[model samples]
Target chain A: MTTPTQQRLSLIDVVNRCDSFPYPSDPRLERLSFLTFIVDEIPCGRIHSSVVPHIVAFNQQDRPVFHITETTISFMPWLADYDSRSDAIAQMLNIWRKAPKSFPSLSGWRDELYGVYTLNTSPLTTKGGAALAIERSACGIFGVHAYGVHMNGYVRTGPRPHEVKMWVARRSATKPTYPGMLDNMVAGGMGFGHSPGYTVLKESMEEATIPIEIARNAVPVGTISYTKLSKDETDSQPETQIVYDLELPADFTPTPCDSEVENFRLWSMDQVLDSIRSGEFKPNCACVCLHFMIRHAVLTPENEPDYLEIAQRLNRRLEFPGCKKWPTFKEEQ
Target chain B: MTTPTQQRLSLIDVVNRCDSFPYPSDPRLERLSFLTFIVDEIPCGRIHSSVVPHIVAFNQQDRPVFHITETTISFMPWLADYDSRSDAIAQMLNIWRKAPKSFPSLSGWRDELYGVYTLNTSPLTTKGGAALAIERSACGIFGVHAYGVHMNGYVRTGPRPHEVKMWVARRSATKPTYPGMLDNMVAGGMGFGHSPGYTVLKESMEEATIPIEIARNAVPVGTISYTKLSKDETDSQPETQIVYDLELPADFTPTPCDSEVENFRLWSMDQVLDSIRSGEFKPNCACVCLHFMIRHAVLTPENEPDYLEIAQRLNRRLEFPGCKKWPTFKEEQ
Candidate 1:
């Protein structure tokens, strides 16, 4: 009897015996990071979860410096102008904290938001005053997005901070593709030459039954930039991804019209982080989103008053001239 | 964002909730093991390659014991009797050594052989007795097979076992199923109450360019039995499977008439196994058949020549009333 190794050899030699001709002018492929959220049970207690931002800043020796604070990691890209760097970072945080009002809103101050952010890195240079070079040559803007929904705080009886009931629509078990999987509330590609906001809005309306106006209000949070790798040798260009954060009510409900979403549910901050750690969440993008929330302390179980105090402290920490401490947790209010 | 635990809970709760009302059984609701070959490359020196079998013994303990070996496996029910076990095992080894006088030959002999052997385990008892319980139960049988002409031994310039000239019929990638898949020989299970030999023969003729007489002489090599699990209260009854082994001439040539097989090539054994490992050879019955092959070393390279020898020795060892090394491979081999 032929062994598995033998069988595999036969198939491989037969299938790949012929020399493969290279195709010129093919678009370079890239690898990009996607974020998603995984909410566990409804918030019921003071949940403690560790946060790890995807971004890493390397020192002279290419070593990472760990920083923990009350909210948000301190790994923002450095700008040539110190003031501009601080301003840009503040703007990004503001977008994350308060849902941008410029975008449309769900009925009665309820809304879902999705956004994309893009950034590029400059090559290391000996000259100190060199102009900041866009990393576009090596990395191209590919996609960015963020989406959120609002719900009444009554979904769970515990302390509520404007509950944002969010659930990933389970992919249909019979779906022609990605069957029996998890899907995000809103999904879109940046380089597709389509508007991420518009795409997410359409996706929200079609998938989660969120009203069109509510999806439109999704504000641009901060832009997240990352590089991607390519699987094909012919395509080695790096792809960049931009991300935006949005806010929603706690009591909001989603009515799925598409069969892709078998069902949905709500989760507490602890449950969400636990699910992420356990690898139970679907649609990996959801896990990224949840990670962001944890790192920012945006989904803690604290009541509104406590949450406000925590948020205030976080804001103060970010105001530090050279805040090395990545946000760890807000002092108990 | 909802967590995975929340999603799992919701799914479980929904299923439980629906269970309150008696539900009708779906015809497709059956325990199915999908098997396929993954061709991989390994260093074997002058030996070229060897076949290893992986077995999934269903309902053995509770989940199933996946046993791997370097011996041929079979599942023909006719060989269930202890007396037939010896001849059956010998016949299987013979098929591997000497290809039967059939067109489309046993190009996929390893897969078929392994499949049959795997099916045999379902009827094995804890005491290692033949558990032919499946004979009294209703069962469905189906198989998807393919002949990889490029995988034939003629392609290799090593010690030429036989001078066989053959071509493969290419399958259409546009076809609804098994698109672009190579096929020269294929056959599968006979539904309950049907003649296994007749069913396989019909399939051979239909899918492979083999003569009926040669197919008939393919011979029954061994029997694989499965034992049902009593722990699964959800599944009221247990199930079993049995498979047969056959061989064809090394020099056999085939002319595929089935549109499913579009093109053909003559490949060495190395190529064939490689294709299976690499997933280039996609057979319709891959799931179950592969499962069976893995369980039973129908055509394992290590035991190809000595399967009969080993089986005979095992029988001899069993005959010894007070054998100390009963279950050990060292004593048996």
Candidate 2:
């Protein structure tokens, strides 16, 4: 058995030696870095708490060919908060080496870059006896997002120059949890035992009042990451977000169901942009959705003639103020 | 514990008392019949077994509500075979019930006419203990003949007026199990353990070369029934089917992934209708799809100018050699 310090060094060395990290400019290569983070920096303890991590290789056609390695790590924050970074790194390496036992001959790993962060410390268990603590550790999440590029539909005159409609949902004032806040059309924490897609689909029905068929119609855009906030940072909880973008008809109406949402409205893009600029859309929920729109070019400068850069700037300036800061490391190009 | 005979008697008593049995002629009462079958007949087996049953109730908005009753009965050929009639009725109920689990709760079950039928089963079990089974039992069988449809943007012309594009999939010749048979775009055994939608989705992806998104758009039109063919019917397999009405772009192209399809061609509606009329389409895969299309108006008289009566005759004609006999019962509506 290797000491924790030795394990950490071995993992760091293996990661540095492996040519898996992609060049920063190449978006595809970034997956390797993310995979490394999942397999190296994040404690195996955290992963095992939620799901078993498996390295699956897909053919050029995107058909899963085989698994190169598989392992279940626990989501134990204590493992992540070891006194030395080397200790944490070593634990991760030990877990990686053991991963092959579950999935023998896996070709490579796929990275799901975004996940939900929740403070609920639940012990997650699988049928196969793999178990992990979910609340304090990083877990890979999956989900579907209904997404489409919103081109300028016929515009109606409004106070703002561009009358593009933005979908906004009001968090249910009557909800036993998270009452009286503005939120995305649909958002929720991915639970330990559910697929991200299944989780999001469930959330959309529960929160946004979107029909399941309609929700399923939402295309799966790529993923996004939100750093988890720490308890001391703010009253707001720590959570990483996996965001999916969906497009609705400009005239689409949402009827809130359950206690997740109280109401919904179609706001003009300019109004939303102005709200962001004025610090009115202060919640991270709004920021996440807004970021998705920007990343996907759902709302671009050209399309939103009255769109102000200040809104974008404000969104960028907002940080997960409650999240704990990790040691900063430079990535090689 | 009740003996199998006693259990059957109890089930029969339950079915007789429930409003679903003996098939209601009034369309409004038909919906009750569908729900009654689920509540009374479906056994309490897992959803993915060879002989599972289900019931689904829909509100005014067509959102489904599910109820999985726990009951299991032995297959008794000696005791009049209830599988045939019960099969279609049960399947329609399951689809009805399962559909809404995906959406929000709408209205409560009220009086409204709804269609019902049985379909082939698809079953699956994840590495997790979660198991899903869509049984091809008596409840899962049904038929429909839709008319007036176009495929790949091409209108039918020539001797046979309606241009019909039927989806035909050849069972994998290399597959050790169920090899080289004609099948629906989606068809599988009961123990395969996958959802009906998932099974069909896989079928469409594998056999039709349709993208997952596009394949999901295919809508369920209705269902059909076929009597068990032999004394060993419980052991002997009867072909199962679920009908869908899909209207594809006229220019749609299908890229066959494997040799499952020996060759495919677009037949003019007249030819397809002629084939059905002449009994040339046969009882294999092509006929099943054609049967569904004709019942749903995808192969309508107006669309396929030549086969106007084909669908009508199919529903009423019991003499068609390929058509399975409708199950018989002492009580009739």
- Off by more than 4 A, model 1: A1-165, A174-178, A223-251, A282-287, A295-333, B1-333
Residue-level lDDT tens digits of model 1 in A123-169 = 23111111111111111111112112211111333332223334555
Lowest-sum lDDT 10-residue window in model 1 chain B: B316-325
- Residue A192 of model 2, lDDT score: 34
Tens digit of lDDT per residue, candidate 1, span B1-333? 223343222211221221221111223323422222211111100100122221222213442222222322233334444334434333433444353332112332322311111112233321222212121111111111111111111222332222222233456677664677654344444332233345556656665667876665443322212111112222121111223323456566655656656655665444443444444544322222222222232222122322111221111100001101112223222
The TM-score measured for candidate 2 stands at 0.27
Note the DockQ of each predicted structure.
0.01, 0.01
- Chain B TM-score for each model? 0.33, 0.39
Clashes of each: 140, 89
CAPRI-style quality class for the chain A–B interface of candidate 1:
incorrect
lDDT of 2 by residue, A1-333 (tens): 223443232211211221122222335532221211122222221122122233221112233321223433222333332122234333343355456644221212322112222222232411111122222112222111111111111123342212346576666667653477555677665433344456566777776667777666443322222222222211112233434545566555777777666777676665554544443332454445454444323443223321222121211111111111111212111
